[model samples]
Target: MSHHFDYPSDETLDISDAYCFAGAGDAHGPRTVFGMNTSPFGAPTWNATGYYELKIDTDGDYIEDITYRATFPIGSDGTQHVQVEQLTGAAARDRTATGMIITPPNAPIGQVVECQGGITLFAGERLDPFYNFIPYPVATTTALKDGTFPDFPAAGPASDSFANTGVRSLVLEVPVKITGREPVHFWATTAYFDKGHNTWIQVQRAGKPNMTTFFDFANGTAKIADYNGTAPTIDLVGRPAHPATDPATGIWGQVRDNIAAVVEAGGTYDQLPHAFPTPRAYGAWAADRLLPNVVKFIPGTVALWDPWCDIQNGKGIIEDIASNIIKMIVNQDFSSGLTPGPVLDYFPYLSTPPPPAS
Candidate 1:
C-alpha cells in the first residue's frame, strides 16, 4: 500500500481548511468559518448527531480561549443549537456560554441567521474556497514515503483539484469587541458526548491548512486518537512518551532533533534565513505553524497584496508558507491556483461549486 494510504486513516475528517475574516462594511460583522468534507461518500450530516466545535485561542498560546459548541439534537425538526463559551488562563478549563441559541435562517442556501447581539450563523454546503496545486501532494507523498526528500519547486501552472468540489461549512459572525485583539487563532473539531465514558470525545480536527497532511505522527495509529482528542497546545517535536502526554511537556526537543537529522542527511532544503536561521529552526517554525491547529486572523492587515481584496486574515500568508515548504519535496510553485473570486463578497462566503459536467 502507498504511504499516503497507509497513514491519515480513512479520511473521516477531510477538513480542507478553516477561516476567520473581518466583516465587510460592518453590516456582516467579523466572521469565523469552519469547513469539513465528509468522507465515505454520503455519511451522516455533522450536526445530525454529535458536536461541531469552533474553538478560538485568542492569546497565541495554542489553547482554547473561546469554544462555540454547535449541537443538533436527534429530535430537532431542522434547527441546530449553538452555545458560545469563553475559556481563560493556561489551564483553559473554564467554559461559560451566554445562554444563547443561534438558529439558522429558514432557507440555508444563501441564508444568514442573525442571533441576538449582532451574531450571525450559517451552516450548509458551499464551494470549497481553498485552492492549491494537485501535483504538490503527489510529489510530497512520494518523497516522504521513499525517503528521497528531494527539492519540490513552485506550482509551475498546476491546477487545484478541490476547486470544483464543495465543503460543508459552519460560519459565525460576531462583533469586533469579542475578537479581543488582532492575530486571533481559530480551529474546529467534531466531538460527541460519550455516555459510556461520560466525556466529550473528539473524532476529527483541523487548524492550519495542511498540518496532518504532511507531518509524520511517529507513533502513527497508536497516538492518532490522542492527537485528535487533545488541544493544539502540544508542541510538535517527537513521539509522545505515552498517549496521555501533557501539552506543557510536549516533545518539542525531539522535533528539533529530528529536524537536525533530516537537515544533516540532506533530506530537506537549505534554510531561508528570512524565515529561520537554519533547517532545524525552520522545522521548529513550521511545527509552531502546524501544531497550533489554529488559523491566525489578523484584522486591518492585508494578508494578500491584491486590489479589492477582502481580509484573508493570515490564511493567504500561511498558504504561501505552506507552499515554500512544499518546495523541499519538489520545486514547483502553485500560486496560480490561489486567485481571488466572487465568493469574497457574498453571505455564505465560499465560491459556488463548479456546475456539473454535461
Candidate 2:
C-alpha cells in the first residue's frame, strides 16, 4: 500500500497525508478499501474540519470517475464525528458539490458506522502505520548533494521513526459495484473550506508513498502548494516542453532529475536501459513511470507494491513500503532494515492507538 507522510514543519498547511488501497473478497462479495492518516502529532489539524477525499479513475485516463470524501467535526466533548459522501462524473471533479451523503451525519469515532450500499466508515486517532529510518529525509538530501547514497544502517539501528506517534485516520470500505469491477486508478487529497474564498481550497494531494518526501527534497518545500493543488493529469502530460540540457523546466523535469540524481549517486544509473546512455535520459524514463502518481488496483487481486519496477497495484497496510521504495530507486536489493509494526486483520486494519500519553 502506498502512503504519504509530509514532514516539513513550515508547510503543515499543505500536508494532505497517507493513503492505502486494498481489495478483498468475502461471503458478501468483493469490496474496495481506502485508508488515510493525517495530522501527525503537534501538527495543525487542517484535515480534521477540512476534507479527506479518495478519487478513483475506472478507465486509464487519470481523471477521476468517482470520489469518496469524509469530513470531521469535533463534538462538544472534544470527540470528532465523521460524515462521508459519494460523488460521480462531474461532481467528482467539482470540489464544491455536496453530492450524496453515505454515512449518517456526525458519526462517532472508534466505532464502525455501516451505511447504505455496503459502505463502512471508521474515523479516529490510530497509531501511525508508516515505518522508516528516522533520518531518511536528511540522508537522502545529503546523498543528492554529496553524490552518494547514505549508509542507512550506519546512521542508526533499525527502528521505526514514526513509532509512538498517532494520526487521525479515516477508513472507508465500499462494495466493488460502486467502484466498478475493472481496474481503477486511486489518489487522495485533503482540503479545507476557505471561507475567505467561499469555496474549499485543496492543500494537498498524494498517491505513491514518499513521492514528495524523496523526490522533492532538493527543492525544499517551494513546490508543495503547486504539487498538491494540481491533478495527476497535469503531471502526466501538462508539463511544458524544455530542452534536455535544462532539467529544471517543469515539475516533471524536476522530479525526473531528482530520481535520476538519486539513482546516479547510488551508482545505478548505468544499470538502467542502455538505450538511454545518459543520466538525463534515464531520469526522463524513470520520471515517466512515477508521474501522474496514482495507485492502480484491480478488484479481487492481491494488493502489492512492486518494489522492483515501481509498479503500484494497490497497497496493503502492512507492506514494508520504505524498503520497497529504497530497492526500487537504487536498483539494489537493499532495505531500511527496520521491522514493521503489526496491524489488525479486520475492518479498520490500522493498529490501535496507544493509551493517552501521560
Candidate 3:
C-alpha cells in the first residue's frame, strides 16, 4: 500500500538493468537504462519525490566523492517536473544542507527550469530501462521457475512493474565525472527522498515495505554472504507486532549497512537492475501448458495473435519479449554504456525484426 523497494526474489518485481551515460526522453536515446522496478502488489499512482543520482569519486579509493541528486516532483497535472543539484563543498559535509531543496524549478514545468547552478532537469516518460517477466507473477510455480533464484524458478517473466499504475520513480543520470565516484566496479543503489522530518533517511534502504518482496535476511545470506543466519529473516511484514527487526543484525541501522556491504562486496546486483536470471528470462519458462504457447505466441504475436494471460496459458509472454529483444543493446565505442539495440530499432515496438545481419 505504502511505498517500498522491489525485491530480488519476487515473481513480479522489475529488477533488471544495463549501462548508460546521458539520459533522455526519446529513450530512442540514453546510453543505458541500468535498472527499473514496479512492484506487482499493484497500487494506484500517487505523488512521491523520485530521483536518479550518481556518486562521483574524483578522489582515490572509489568511495563516493560528492553525490549528485535529482528529484522529480510532479505538477498537479501529473507531468514530471525535475530538479538537479550536487552536494559538495559545505553542502555535503553539512548534514543540515541535506534537507534543503536546493534546486527548485523556476518557470514551473514549461519544458525548462533553472535547476540550481545551470543544470536543466527534464522530466517525462522514457522507455523504461529495466525489463522482466510479466503476467508470470500470477503464473504457475513450475511455469516461471528456471534461471530465477534457485529456490524460486517461476519468477522469470519481467515487466516494467511501473507501467502507468503510479510507480513514481526517481532516476538520476549522473555525468561520468560523478558516477565515477565508484570504480567501474563500484555500486549503484536507488531510493526515495524521505520528505518526513527524518527525510534524509532512505526508507527503502532502511527496511523495504512488506507484501512487496520475498527477499529477507536469509535471502541475502544465501545469495551473497551469511549476513543473516540460516533462517529467512522476513522484514516489515507485520511490523510493530513482529516489528521489522533482525536479531542477527543487532540494530536496524546495521541491517541496511550489512545488506549494502554484502552486495557491494560480492559484486552482485541487488534490488534494482533486476540483473539476475529467472525462469522468466526465456519465453518458455512458463507452466507446462503455457510452455508450448510461448513458442506459439512470440513468433505469432506479429500475426495479430497474442499470448493469453489466464491460468492455462499466456503467462510470461510480455515479460520474455521485453527482456530478450526489447531491452538488449550494444555499448558505444566510448563505453558510455548500453544503447538501444539494432534489433529493437528494426522491430516496430509491436512486432519488428533485428537489423539486417549487422
Candidate 4:
C-alpha cells in the first residue's frame, strides 16, 4: 500500500468519496483476530495515526451527502478511540463543524468502547465474523458427495474458528441513511501520517468497508478498490476471471462449483497456496441486488439475506451468503435475474496501480 491514490475514472475512492466505511474482524488480534491472522494484513504505514472518515452519497450522482469520521489513539496499540459526525456540503470540510463526537446509543457492549468529542470509540475483539475457509473440509467443498456441488451452503451452520490474530482491528459503522441506502456496494482504504517523514501513506484494504477481505469475489476473481497508500501491491491468490456484463446472466455457478472442486483437492493442504480468495461473484451478486440500481423494480433492497456479525455488523457476509444461495439455485446459469436471494455486487473497478515505495 502506498500513500498515492488510484483514480479509476481518473477517479479515486476514499473517505472523501461517497458511501464508505472501514471494518475488520476481531479488532484485538495479536497481529489479527483469531481465524484471520493467516496474514499480517492491514498493518498501518509509518507514523500511522488514528483518524479516518466514512464518506458516502446515498444516490450515485457523485455528490457526497454524508460524512462519518473515526479518530484513533495516535500511538502504538491503536488506542481505537473513535468519532462520528453528520454533516452536509462544505460544512463537513471544516474540521470544526463536520467533526463531532456522538454516543453510539444502544450499540453493543463493546461496539463503542468510548466516545469523545463526537467520536465514539469501540476497539476490542469481536468474533471473526467474516465467513472464510470454514464450513468444509475444504472451502467451497460441499457435503453433496455425489460429485456435484451441494444445492445450498455446505456448512451446517456459521461457526467462528477463533483463529488468533496479532493486529488490533480498527473501524466504525454509520447508519444506512448516512450511506444513503439501507445497503450498498461500498469500498474502503486507510491513510496514516508518518510524522517522522511529515507525510501520509495509504492502503486499500481490498474490498468494501466493514467487509472481510475474503468477500470481494466475483466470477472467481475480486475487484480490489484503488487506494492511496505506500505499501507494496498485495498478492491475490486463485484464478482470475474477466468482469461480467450483467449479474442475471453470467458464468458464476461454474466458477463457484469449480472453486469448490479446488478446495476439495488434497482435503487438507500439505503444500503451498492452500487458502485462497473466494470467487468474486459472491461480493458482486450481493451488491447488485441490495444496492440501488435501475435494472429491476425494487431498488436498494434485497428480498432475502440473513448474514451479519451480530457484533460489529458483518455487512459483507449479508451480501456473500445471498450470492451463494443464488448461485446454487442458478445451477451454473450466472445470468437469470430470478435470484434465490440477492447476490453480491462487484466493484465498478478493481486494484489500483500501487504508489512508489518510501
Candidate 5:
C-alpha cells in the first residue's frame, strides 16, 4: 500500500488510493470500487480539503476515458458534505472540466448516495485499510545500503504500521456497465483549486501501491512531485532529462538502477536465473513490469493482486500489496508478514474509524 506521505513535507497530500472490481455476484451487480484515504484521519475537521478523482482508461490507450471525482465542502454544522461527478471523453482528460454532478451535493459523510446509473458514493473518516510491516522502508533502505534483504521474523513479530490509525476516505462504487466488460486501467489524483494560477494543481497521483515510495526513494522532492504531477503515459516513456549531471534521468533508468543496486548487493542473481548474466539485466526486465504504474481490471471478474496469481487484475483493500510488491522486486517469496484487519462486507466496505485517542 502507498504510505501517502511519500512526497516532500511541503507538498504533502496524503491521498493513498486503492481499487478493486467485484464480479456480478455482488449486490451492486458487478461494481468497481475506488478508495482514497488521507492521513491523520480523525480530526475535529476533515484534513483533506481538496477534491480527489479516480481516472479510468477504458480503451487501453493509457488515457482516461471516464473519471469519477469527489469534492468535499464543510457545512455550518462542521460536517463535510460530498459531491460526486462523472466526466467522460475530453472532460475526463481535462482537469478543469466539471462534467456533471452524479450525487446530491448535500449528502454528508457516512450517508450513502445512490446516484443515477447505480453509482454509490460515501465520504468520511474510515479505518485505513493499508497494512505493512512497520520497518519495511528501513529494510528496503538497508538493502540499498548494505545488500541485506529483510528477514520478517528478525523484524520482531510483524507489526502493522497503520493499525488503529484512520484516514479521511472517499469511496465510490460504479456499476460495471459504465466501464463495460473490457479491461480498464485506473489511477487516482488529489488536486486543489489554485486561486493564484486560476487552475487546478495536482499535488498527488497514485496508481500502483508503493511505486513512488519504494522505487523512487533516491529522488529528491522536485522529482517526487514531478512523478505525482504527471500521467501514466509519461511514466511509460520516461521523465525529461534532469538538470543535474546524472544521466539516469528517465524513470525507467532510475528504477532499474535502484533495483539493480539491491540485487547486486544482496547477490540474488540466482533468484532470476533467466534474466541472465548480470543483476542489471534482471533489473531492466523488472522495470518494464513496474512502469506505467496503473491498476488494470477487467470488469465482471474478481480483483486480486497476488504475484503468483496468473491475473493480477486490481488491488483489493485488504490485499497484501506490500508483500507482493517486495516479492516482485527481489524475485523471491518475500512477505510483509502482517495481515490486514477486518472490514465491513457491504457498501462503503471499509471498517469504521477507530475512536479518537483519549
Candidate 6:
C-alpha cells in the first residue's frame, strides 16, 4: 500500500512504506524499529556516495528531534560497509554525521550487524514485508476517476499481491532510551551529496504508507517528483498556514482535495463512519488522515495493540496524522496479515527470503 514504482527511476521504485515493529526485541531494555526500502527493484549499488536517513521526533510536535544517518562506503576489498551516525542539535539541517559505527551489511539473511549505540543494522535483499491485495494501478486508473473503486465491505478479503516481491531494506533497531522512550514519530529518506553542486538533494522519501500510491496522483494527476522533493514540514503544513478553502496548497492539501473529490463524486460516504453524518464531514475526517507523514511508535509496546494504536490513533494538529486510515482500511480486523511470516524472533526481525523457486 505505497507508491511502488510511482517515481520515474530505480531510486524511487517500490519504496513501499516505513514499517514499524515495537517490542520486537528487548536486548537493550526495550527496542523499537523503523524500516523501509530504498533503490528496491534493481541491481543497484548502495556504494559510498548515497545517504539513507531516519528522522525522529520525540516531542510529538512533528519537528525533527534526532536524525540517524546511514551510509555505505567502499572498503579496501571493494565491499560496501554500513556506517551510521546520530545527528543532534543543528546537524539535522547542516548534515553533519557525528557518532559513527561502521559495519558490513547483513549477510546470509541471518547475520545482523550489531552497531554502536545499541542499534542493529541490516541492509540487504529481503522479502517485501508489506502485504495487501489492492491493485493500485487498476484501482486508480479505472475506478478512482470513474468512481467505481471496489467496496471493501462487499468485497472478500483482498489477496496479498506482494507476497513474493523483494526490496533492498534498511532496518534499524534503536533503544527506547536513545529516542527518549516517549511517543516518537519517524520517517525515512534517501539522498546523496552532489559533488558538483556541493549540496544534498533528496531523491526519495516515505512516511505514511500509500501516500504516493493513492494521494500523490489524485484525480489522475501526477505530483510524484514534486511530492518527493518537498520536505515534510512544508508538505504537511503549508508555507504559511491558511484556511481549508485556500488553493490546493501542499501534499496533504492536494490529497485532501483529491480524496474529497473522489468522495463527493463517487458517493462513497457509506464507507466512512456514520458519525460523519454528511459528505463534508466525511471529507474532513478522511482528509485529516494525510498530514504529518510519519509513523508514531510508542516505546516498549506490542505493535498494533490497542494502546499502541491509541497513541498512534489520536489525530494531532497539522503537524501529525494518525495511522487510522490504513487501519480503518483493514476494516477493524487487527490480527491478520499485519506482519505475516518472515518475522524472525530476534534482532533485525524480517524473515529470510525463500529459496529460489525450484
Q: Find the candidate with the highest lDDT and give its number.
A: 5
Q: For residues 1-358, what per-residue lDDT tens digits would candidate 5 score against the true structure?
A: 6645474343325666557656224554577787667654344444345667889999999899988887777778766677788999999988777888888757777777888787888877788887876577557745644445655466666788789887777777778779887888988887777898788778777887777777553352225767777888876454324312223446776776677767666667456433445766666666666767788988777778764333478888888887777765676667666778988888788889888789
lDDT of 3 by residue, 1-358 (tens): 1113333333222222212222332312222111222332332331244434433334433334455555556678766555555776446433345533546643342233334432333332233332333432222111112212121134533434533332223233333333332222112233443556554422222111111222233423322112211111222221222122223232222233333232333333322333323212211111111111011111111211112222221112123322222111100011112233212331111112112222
TM value for model 3: 0.38
How many clashes (backbone N, Cα, C below 3 Å) per candidate?
17, 2, 41, 68, 0, 2
lDDT of model number 6? 0.57
Score candidate 1 by lDDT.
0.49
The digit string of per-residue lDDT tens for model 4 on 1-358 reads 0111222221121221122222221233111000011012223321124334444434444233444544433335444333344566765433345444464533332343444322334333322223322333233233212233443344444433322322223334332223333333223335445579766444333222222222222443434342123111111122234322222312223333343443344232122222223333333333333222111111223222322211112223223332333233222322111212221232111112123335
Candidate 2: stretches off by over 4 Å: 1-17, 42-48, 74-79, 145-148, 217-221, 238-248, 272-276
Q: Order the candidates by lDDT, highest first.
A: 5, 2, 6, 1, 4, 3
The residue ranges of model 3 lying beyond 4 angstroms of the native Cα positions read: 1-62, 72-81, 89-95, 99-104, 107-120, 134-199, 205-215, 218-358
Better of 1 and 6 by TM-score: 6
Regions more than 4 Å wrong, model 4: 1-48, 74-80, 84-98, 101-121, 134-186, 194-200, 205-358
All candidates' lDDT scores? 0.49, 0.69, 0.28, 0.30, 0.70, 0.57
| Span of 10 residues, lowest total lDDT, candidate 6 | 314-323
Estimate the TM-score of every prediction.
Answer: 0.71, 0.86, 0.38, 0.38, 0.88, 0.79
Per-residue error (Å), model 2, residue 343: 0.9
RMSD for each of the candidates: 6.5, 3.4, 15.9, 14.9, 3.9, 5.3
| TM-score of candidate 4 versus the correct structure, residues matched by position | 0.38
- What tens digits encode model 6's per-residue C-alpha lDDT throughout 1-358? 4456464454533355566666354655777777776544544566357677788878777777777787767767666666777776567655644644444342322347776677777777777666655543335434334544434434334565667766677788888778766788787777767789988877666776566656544324666766776666765553224334455456655555555555555565555333334444444444554566677777776554122133353111111112234433222223223334455666566667645656
Among all candidates shown, the one with the greatest TM-score: 5
Order the numbered candidates by TM-score, best leading: 5, 2, 6, 1, 4, 3
1 or 4, which is superior by lDDT?
A: 1
